[model samples]
Target: MRPLLVAALLVLIWTSPVTARATGSVLSGIAVEDVAWDDGTALQIHWRTKLDEDFRVLIVREGTDGLMDTLGLFPANVQWVVDDDVTPAGTYRYRLSVFDSEGILVFTAASHGLASPHANWFHRGRLGEALIILGVFAMILWGTFRRRDIYLRPIGGLSAIEEALGRAVEMGRPVLFSAGWGAQLDKPTTMAAMNIFGWLASRAASYDARLLFPTHDAVLMAAAQESARESARIEGRPDWYRPEDIYYVTGSQFGYAAALDGIMERQKPAVNLWLGTFAAESLILAETGNHIGAVQIAGTDSTIQLAFFLVTCDYTLIGEEVFAASAYLTRDSMVLGGLWAQDWLKIGVAVTVIAGLVGTLLDWDAIGGWLRGI
Candidate 1:
């Protein structure tokens, strides 16, 4: 009976209140969130340490099965470590270990999982974007079918284009067409500039007029060449596409100005059309063209440059009129649709502004407060 009691007492002693202790500081397991899988085949794991827990360092481990079996330790934070580069795109398991003020309390590590690949737009969303594009195109087609005779408000600058080319022809001199620095495919101004170039080139070919083009952008140069060649062909003068005439000037902003200045001083063109985007170079080019007795007609949407052109050139197109040139010149369906859309948008904006002012005067707070409280 005593042997039986001794064995039961030993069992109770072995099972009851088993406590394990360590001398170092105790660390709570790391807390993590907002895991991002980037395109570079990497996973980013972010975590925060326990609040008010004093620790000598932090240890992070990545494991395939999330059991710190194959462990790795992240370097100290004070070393300016970039931890993101080492993390791979797979099931990433992380464990955090630290020493606290009291003792070492190592908690179990938490794991987050994700797969990474190229970002994809949803098929439905892609379809929607396609539909929006098609809708825009359809509206343009509708505008074309229901075409109205748009009496283009006369632009003094546009009106001067022919006269400028004609003046050059009369003097047996070259007509200089600078699409301006603004005539880059990436730039909104270039579209307007190209439209003007098309018109000018056609007129030049018809009159056996010499056309000279200087471009500051490679894209603009290519476009200007195509437009000039096309215009000449349309004018039944396919042989008139002069490669040397439409040449590239330096791409540097002021470098172009200086190159053009030299050309103007040398060729002394009879007519100069500076159309497209211009910057500080606007005045410099126009002034040089002016000094050569060229009939300078400049058009730009730049408000700052308009004043300079007005002072120097024979005629200038200002602000929105410059944008309107494509619609006026091409009479293209899309361009017309854009113009119409803007017209309606402007009307809407005007009505909104007016309504806002009137509502303020009438004390709109009563309506706003009622809505807010409800």
Candidate 2:
């Protein structure tokens, strides 16, 4: 009986390939890679496993001390999975393991990888965006060095500078320039206003006319004083600048408007140049200037305030025209160059947008894809 049993076991072992190895596995080619176009929070895992329906794949994630823990079970046919809960710049390891019928471990394929996802510096999906930005800036900087002429369309508000100053001079009244409620010299609107203010101060000083700046912010007042003095000096009328001319009004929004309105009613400035940012006080100031019968010239980036000024003021700088006025009035080489670069960039953007629209309508993706890839 012992001889018969031993012979039968040996025959079974010889016939079954599973006895050749203690455990057998058929999972292979497992890999991990970063997910594209994301903010570094995802990873993709890919693997090949036995295609036979008899096998199941286990997705294993790393635990502490490099221990493996089963994340989930998957069908053998699944080739890839995306893990979006991973942390950025974190290292990780994953395994694709196979199991056979009767719960026997069959095979495993591991890949030590990372959660270090990257933000696409230039969203290749946006195609020509980065290229356009770089090209525009490069052209602007080049304009600064080359001292080339940049053609710009005539802005009515910018062209009115001399006429406004002349009116102030003729009327023997001060020229009022105000950066309404949100005036912080560091802000973009205020900075642009300063550029135009320099020209205003220079022209006013040259004409022996007074320039007034009543501001709600102390910082803006200080900047305005310095700008006035510098402009006076540049225009060869150093004595024309008075520190008291740029004064700080109350910080309260409506209070500031009331104070300026009083001044407008009493002093009746010949030319009222409203620039920078404004809120509710925008209409208040414009209407007061109108009531006082002053020649009001206004520019602002604030859409709502700009609309008010357009209807109330004699001349208005619409939207980006305020920034453009800075370049046009000052004629600084760098600024002019920036304007030229910006215009060309706008043209390029318009063309691309039209092309993209046409392509989308016609069912052609090449134009859109190429721009985003750039």
**Top lDDT prediction, candidate number:** 2
Candidate 2 residue lDDT tens string, 67-100: 5444566667777888776667566788665656
Residue-level lDDT of model 1, residues 1-374, one tens digit each, is 74463344334433554232443333332333322334343344444443342432333445455533222333223312223433344444454443344433333234444323232333442464577567666655665565566556677777677677778888999988887765577777777777778887888889989999888887778888899899999999998888789988889989999999999999999988887778899999999998989998888877789999999999888878878887876777667767776665577568756776677789875534433454
**Model 2 whole-model lDDT (C-alpha atoms):** 0.78
Which candidate achieves the best TM-score against the true structure? Answer: 2
Q: List the residue pairs that clash in candidate 1.
A: 24-104, 25-103, 25-104, 26-103, 26-104, 26-105, 27-105, 182-277, 183-190
The TM-score that candidate 2 achieves is: 0.70
In order, the Cα lDDT scores of the candidates are: 0.67, 0.78
- Model 1 residue runs over 4 Å out of place are 1-89, 96-108, 112-118, 122-146, 302-304, 332-334, 347-374
Per-model C-alpha RMSD: 12.2, 10.3
